[model samples]
Target: MQINKRHQVSPYLVFFIIYNSQVGVGILGFQRTIAAKAGYDAWIGVIIAGSFVQVFIWMMYKLLAKADGDIVDVHSKMLGNLLGSVPSFVIMIYYWLASVSVILSFIEIIQVWMFPTLPSWILCSLILGLVYYCVSGGFRVVVGVSFLSFIIPQLLFIVLYLYPLKSAHFSNLLPILNHSYKELFDAVKSSMYTIAGTETLLMFYPFIREVKSSKKFAHLGVLFTTILYTISAIISFTFYSESQLKETIWPELSLTKVIRLSY
Candidate 1:
């Protein structure tokens, strides 16, 4: 297959894709997972995890920029034809699993929250079709959709955060560093998976318009996403106890429920 060398995406679009892809699925459950280790100090765990992810993103970008090709080509070159295939296959499987999991989770969320009567398969099919349409348009369309997804959903967050403020108990975040350092490290490592999508940079570097500034964009994107994740984690920790967080499957959404819009 001949590779098409098309116009590259803007840095903002790159940021959108990285942020949206990472934020999906994981955001709903991130607080509970971190609370398991750091208790009410989960926000610190999120910050530590975000920093680790930024480092990984930097390393992946450096490797890709040095390779002079997309991830598959670079892997084959670095690891040789046979050994390289192993990592490539593993990555392919990971992407496939992640895609399916995201789709299923979206359906499950919609079924529970919005369309209680709808069958799971019906919701899944509708979502899968939309994903297929976006994916079929190739990388540019997917990036465009990602940009839209990141912006629109974010507006609701402002309302969600505001409602919880009056009732929030700042004392919930006290007694910081109460957990052992090892436990905090483990929480950071686990939450690092939430920011894992930046690894897509390995494939995207070849498509980035300003390849010279790709590193800057990648780091900037990670920094922006880390801030968002940290804020959400902090809010969830302050609003819910460690046990309450564990009991709530979707802490952010649970927080949103407290906000009643009279208009």
Candidate 2:
């Protein structure tokens, strides 16, 4: 876990990696997925899930502090070489799965919205090439890309969502407590994947330049993600009826269809 000088990034960059890592393809369909269970109260589920994310951030920092390294080190020390290597290998596989999931989701979006005829292998190859380039340059380059990716799309997509509100039926969000506690719990679980990738922090925390001070920014990063998720849920609930939302696959993307441009 001896990070070289060139590989370390400022603590503030931690915000970008954590925030962007959690805000991927999961958000694209999360509204409908959560709404199906919690009805109009799903926004509350989003908030609850976000609260769990904040707790997770704290837990990870605590673990990293104790280990003075990443999760790999924790497992190695807590269990012993052979036993610990099992979980470490599993984590590596899990990371590969997560990467594939996000890439496929984006490729699906491209096929549906931009290039209906594009082949999946072509897209995968292109995306993996870019991934190889980013990974080869090392962590700092990846962090820079992540920061820009989160900020730029967030600005434009937030604007896209705003116009949908012009025709939104706020009454759609009424009877907010209609769901039972069990149903709300289901919704919260459903929204959890939107915050799933933050766990990767355990692998990257050792690279923060001011590792101790960076805890503050890491919490801020989680807070920022929670606020974004909460806002998106609120807008989506207000914009669509409960039944309508449940039937739609990607309501956030569908909302953009309502946007109009002036000449």
Candidate 3:
């Protein structure tokens, strides 16, 4: 399905969409899970995981450039319709699962932190309603909303992470290379699973105003996300002790609890 030229977005806009999608859900608590195995070494795992994303982004661009089509079309050409669409089905299913995971995580956060009395079904319905409204507006609306999501969070990131630095023990990040290579690799794998939405580029590639520029923007998105995650992991690990980190479900959120602004 070709996206009409009229509905397409600037290649630069791809950066924000990629930012919004990858930064969702997982970053909140991923530090704890990755650190569970590697301890403070998890920050290194974040850089390694981002490197994997860079390689994948490069590979995706090369493949799309060569195939000159979206993933579905490429699959159809390579595998007959029956075989080709199997991969598309798998990709769509991955998307659906990731979406559900993100939504459920946010609902859990609300339940635990804000409104224990709020019905999950009601929250789910409201979210689905918002999804429907966005879908009804078409892809442009989706992109616009995602762009705003990326923009609006800049202040929050600063407030949440920077303000906590006063109490953060940068010393906690020491003894960093203490973990074995295998431990680091396992942590990287855990982080990668959370960052897996980059495949979304395959679908939006056809809608880019300039394909080459979009590819660059896509890599930038990954790089930016990598830095963000890496720094976040460091902050979380530093702000919490090894045992505290293991016990905390959302280290990133915990950072916000310590946030202070000097008068």
Candidate 4:
């Protein structure tokens, strides 16, 4: 539980970690699932889901700060090591399953668009191997990777949005509150799963250099991602009709097809 200062990363990096965790494979196609339930009003659901994540982040910081350790430590404190391991094991299994799901989703995307002949197992293995190497290096190394992961794709994503904007039907978002409350809630529920990775904070809280100051950065990261996702959802809604979005698996990825460069 006592992490050496050398192993701890700066509080500011927590923003990148939070951002990196929350925006993964889910963002690519979540617009469809949410819009399916609440129509264009689904962007509202994204904001609602993000508000919930902010509260969850606050709860995590409070709990972790009290225990002065990660979730495993908190569990052990509450239920002795013997009983605590059960829930901890379950949590680890959940993380394992989630990781596999994300990896497989990403692999499927690659195979569909880039490498139809690539075997899933081989790609999966290579990805896991890279993950193992980075993780084995230590938490600081992992944090460094998270920082790069947050930084590298930003410009490309911004450019991808330009093409979609030109063809967008802004009227698609008109009748925003037309959906019933139940439908909007369903959209919120789905958006919650898409933006769910903020829980990673539970595992890394102890590794942060200044826990108190990091709290604000963590919240700010959530705020930024929330806005990004909302904009993405709105863009997809405006660019594709509701029915077309339902048929498109990766609306965000499909947006890239519209981009053309002049020589």
Index of the highest-TM-score prediction? 4
Q: Estimate TM-scores for all models.
A: 0.93, 0.97, 0.96, 0.98
Cα lDDT tens digits, model 4, 195-250, are 99998998998889979999999999999999999999999999999889989999
Instruction: Please list the residue runs of candidate 2 whose C-alpha ends up more than 4 Å from where it truly belongs after superposition.
Output: none
lDDT for 36 in candidate 4 is 88
Stretches of model 4 off by over 4 angstroms after superposition:
none
Q: Which pairs of residues clash in candidate 2, taking residues 3 or more apart in a chain or in different chains?
A: none
Off by over 4 Å in 1: 1-7
Q: Alpha carbon lDDT of residue 137, candidate 1?
A: 90
lDDT of 1 by residue, 122-145 (tens): 888888888789889988888888
Better of 1 and 2 by lDDT: 2
Model 2 TM-score (2 dp): 0.97
Could you tell me the TM-score of candidate 1?
0.93
Q: Which ten residues in a row have the lowest lDDT in candidate 2?
A: 167-176
Greater TM-score among 2 and 3 belongs to 2
Q: Return the top candidate by lDDT.
A: 4
Report, for every candidate in turn, its global Cα lDDT versus the true structure.
0.80, 0.87, 0.86, 0.93
Q: Judged by lDDT relative to the true structure, which candidate is superior, 2 or 3?
A: 2
Candidate 1 lDDT trough over 10 residues, lowest sum:
1-10
